[model samples]
Target: MKTMRFTPPGYGGRRRDPEQVKRDGWREQGILAVSVDDERLTWPERELVRQLGDRLYGPRAADDGGRHG
Candidate 1:
């Protein structure tokens, strides 16, 4: 959606697809991924959060930064 601009939805009765993805070519049978406002925050934002966590907590002694709050 960011690469190209789109017209307002339902302006001319053109609507979005019900299923975001098709399982035709995909090998995985059951996988659902939902993206919200995808244009915001790239990988750097996630990395920055990781770096800040390390800096504030000193590399997380034994934890591998896996647990989610």
Candidate 2:
């Protein structure tokens, strides 16, 4: 008898595609913009936007209030 471990597909921290990463960056930027400028995001949504911005650009990413190229 052999013991087996289940591993999900794309596991082991597979790198995200570059284009997908770029799109994600753009989406995060949009979310942060709406949260800060339009007051559109709920608390949780705003937190999520902040986290995404930190991940994509760094801590300062959200500081500009989503104004970035």
Top candidate by TM-score: 2
Candidate 2 residue runs with Cα over 4 Å from true position: 1-37, 61-69
lDDT of 1: 0.51
Deviating ranges (above 4 Å) for candidate 1: 1-41, 61-69
Give lDDT tens digits, candidate 2, residues 7-69: 678676568886577668778775223343336567787777777867876876547677987
In candidate 1, which residue pairs clash? none
For candidate 1, what's the RMSD? Answer: 15.0
Q: In candidate 1, how many Å is residue 33 off?
A: 22
Residue-level lDDT tens digits of model 1 in 7-61: 5665666444645353422336664332222345477765565566678666654
Model 2 global lDDT (CA atoms, 0 to 1): 0.65
* Cα RMSD to the true fold for all candidates: 15.0, 12.1
Candidate 2: 10-residue stretch with minimal lDDT: 31-40
**For model 1, where is the 10-residue window of minimal lDDT?**
31-40
**Per-prediction TM-score:** 0.27, 0.35
Task: Please list the C-alpha lDDT of all candidates, in the order they appear.
Answer: 0.51, 0.65
